[model samples]
Target: MTTLVKLDHVTRRFGDITALDDVSLEIDSGRIVGLLGPNGAGKTTLLSLVQGLRRASSGTVELFGGSPADARTRRHLGCTPQETALPPTLRVGEVIDFVGAHFDNAVPREELAAEFGISELLKRQTGALSGGQKRRLSVALAFVGRPRLVLLDEPTTGLDVDGRRALWAAVHRQQDAGATVVVTSHYLEEIEALAERVIVIGQGRVLVDDDLSAVLDQVGLRLLRLTTPTPDRVRALTGVVDSRPEHDGSFTFFVQDADVAVAELVRSGIQFSGLTVRGATLEEAFLTLIADSPKQNDAAGVSPRGI
Candidate 1:
């Protein structure tokens, strides 16, 4: 596969606050990659570098084998930032037409609107649209150009459940149509839904980069929640990573093997009630990684910045 985006020894700083550090990464053509991180963890900074909204302080960033800032490179790219600025007085149809006019291969206005479930809002003035409507419109605009690479930064930020699901469907359709997409969102379920590959960043450095299943395996942990008379005994159970007493006298245990923990509980004759076991979520994995190593710089030989 051709490499659509490349960051080589890249770094970006904002007056000594390292937004991205010693980072090197590549995004190949036609992949759905999720970018996850906490606030100020450099997710926005990385997307900015890719979109050519900002220059990297050091290192190299390339899009389609050309500088990201090049007009030729940008012509094939589409981006929906966390916030969008739309012409208040413009009707939805007019706004679509304006952006669509920029690309030779733009998708037809009617078709794009239909696909995004915003066709009915075509006659409405952008200013009168609700927040969710505006969000859907902003995301739809990204695809108006029939872009080969799409960057969606918190694309569903203000969207309701139905709106978010519609956007996810649109993203899936884009990927199926052969666009390489990079998405950043605080919602882990969104990432889980749309991304095949996952890149987890923390404190401006990459903590994990792998296929979604592999990344989850690396964070292999189960949570066991139950009510026990002896909370301390649960903490001492084998394979238990940690235990926390809930407000209602229940205890939650982080365990490497839930089955083993349960067996131990049985052998100890512990009368645990309301036993529940669930797999760890992406959010849990992300938090664990951050908690384990909140602020570690990259290796000395690397540079920084990404998306």
Candidate 2:
């Protein structure tokens, strides 16, 4: 596979704050890779370096086998950041044209708009559209240049269910057309739906990088949710990785093995009810990684936000 983007021992800082630390990864061509992390986990900082919007503080960032800082190297790249501010006065078609004008042989506005399910809004001014519609337009603009590598940060932030699904379909189509996509989303289900490989970041460092199934399986955890009168004792149960009390007077336990954990709970004579055990979802695994990270920098004050 072709390596489209590479970061070697990269670190980025804002004043005294380190947003990304000693990061090294390669984004291969034609894969939908999900970048998963909590807020302020340095996801955006990494993407910014890839897009040449910011320079790495200590190491190298390469795009298309060249420096990301070079305009020529980024010609085949497209990015939709966490926040998009479209010109209110510009019509949807006008905005597409404006962004497309910078690239050679850009996709036609009509074609690009149709692919992203925004064809009907072409005549409307950006200010007049709904939040979902505006988000669709913003994402569509990224593909106007027919990029080979697309970086999408929180692409479906404001979209409804159907809208989000439609964008997922659009993303699949992009991948089918031989584009590499890097997506960062708070929605773990979104990553599960669209990504084959997952790279999880936490505390300004990579915590997990593996195939989707491997990442899930590696956690080897089960979620046990039950209403226990003695929540404090439930948290200290053997095999429990972490425990959280739900808003509705229930405790959720992340356990190494549900059966063993449940057996231990029952043997201990804890008064609990409404017990349900299931395999840990991506969200659970991601959270477990963050909580168990050797480098716990969350207490170090807020840094950059990825989405």
Candidate 3:
């Protein structure tokens, strides 16, 4: 795949605070990459640099081999910011046409609207639309130009399950049509459903970057829930990362291999019941990654909050 965007040792600062710290990564064309992090993790700042909304304090940022700040470079980019303020009085079709005017080869207005499931509301005024409709329209506008690269920052902030799935389908179609997409979202399930690669950031720095399967394998986690009185012994078993007690005399153990842990429990005569083992969710894998990430110390040797 062709490299669409590149950042080398990039750092962004606001006043006395650093928002991104010595970050380096590349987005390849034709891939849907998921950016995962907690609140204030500098995910937004990173996207801003790529969108040319903010300048990097140090190092380099390249969009399609040109400076992101250049209009020529930005022309091939489409973005849906976290907050969207559309002209309320304009009809939905008019609003779509307004955004399409910026690109010389814009997608047909009606086709674009239909692709995003807004064809029925094209005649409705923007102000009269529901929250979900507004959100979908905000996202659909990003594809109006048929951009080569799309950056979506929490695109489904206020949508029901069906709405979210509809948006996801539109994104998949975009990728299938040869668009590279970078999605920054708090929803783990969204990432799991949309991304082929996952990048995790913490404390304003890159914590994990790999294929989705490899990221899950990096932690090799399995959630084991059971009833056991000897929590200490359960925790001491090999392959067990940690264990926590529940109110109903149950324990949830983070383990590498449920079979190994269970076998060990039986062989050692450790008392356990109500045993159940399940695969880790993307959220569980993400939490484990950030928890084990080393905090980057600042000039004063203090750990600062993620920007």
Tens digits of per-residue lDDT for model 1, 1-307: 8899999988999997999998999999867999998778899999899988899999999988899888778888998733358888999999999988889889998999999998899999998988998999999888888888999989998788988998999899988998889999888889999999999998888889999899989888899999977878887878887555566778777788888989998999977899999987776656657655624322211212121
> Which structure among the candidates has the greatest TM-score?
2
Q: Tell how far residue 284 is off in model 3, in angstroms.
A: 0.4
Model 2, position 300: C-alpha lDDT score:
19
How many residue pairs of model 3 clash at the backbone? 0
Task: Name the lDDT value of residue 278 in candidate 1.
Answer: 91
In model 1, which range of ten residues has the least summed lDDT?
A: 298-307
Candidate structures ordered by TM-score, highest first: 2, 3, 1
lDDT of each: 0.84, 0.86, 0.84
Once fitted onto the true fold, the runs of candidate 1 whose alpha carbons sit more than 4 angstroms away are 81-84, 226-251, 261-275, 294-307
**Could you give candidate 3's per-residue lDDT for residues 1-307 as a string of tens digits?**
8888999999999999888999999999977999998776899999999989899999999999999999889888998733348788999999889888999889887899889988999999988989899988888888989899999988887788999999999999998998889998878878988999999987788988999888878867898999987888888889887555656778878888889988988998988889889987766665655656445212112222121
Q: When superposed on Cα atoms, how far off is each prediction in RMSD?
A: 5.8, 3.3, 4.8
TM-score of each model, in listed order: 0.85, 0.91, 0.87
Instruction: Kindly report which residue pairs in candidate 3 clash with one another.
Output: none
- Cα displacement (angstroms), candidate 1, residue 289, comes to 1.3
Q: Relative to the unseen true structure, what is the C-alpha lDDT of residue 38 in candidate 1, on a scale of 0 to 100?
A: 76
lDDT of candidate 2 over 1-307, digit per residue (tens): 9999989999999999999999999999967999998878999999999999999999999999999888889889987733348888989999999989989989999999989888899999888989888888878877878899999989999788999999999989988987888999888889988999999998789989999989988987898999978888877877888776666878778899888998999999999999999887777667777877645534312222232
**Taking the candidates one at a time, how many backbone clashes does each contain?**
6, 0, 0
Off by over 4 Å in 2: 81-84, 229-233, 294-307
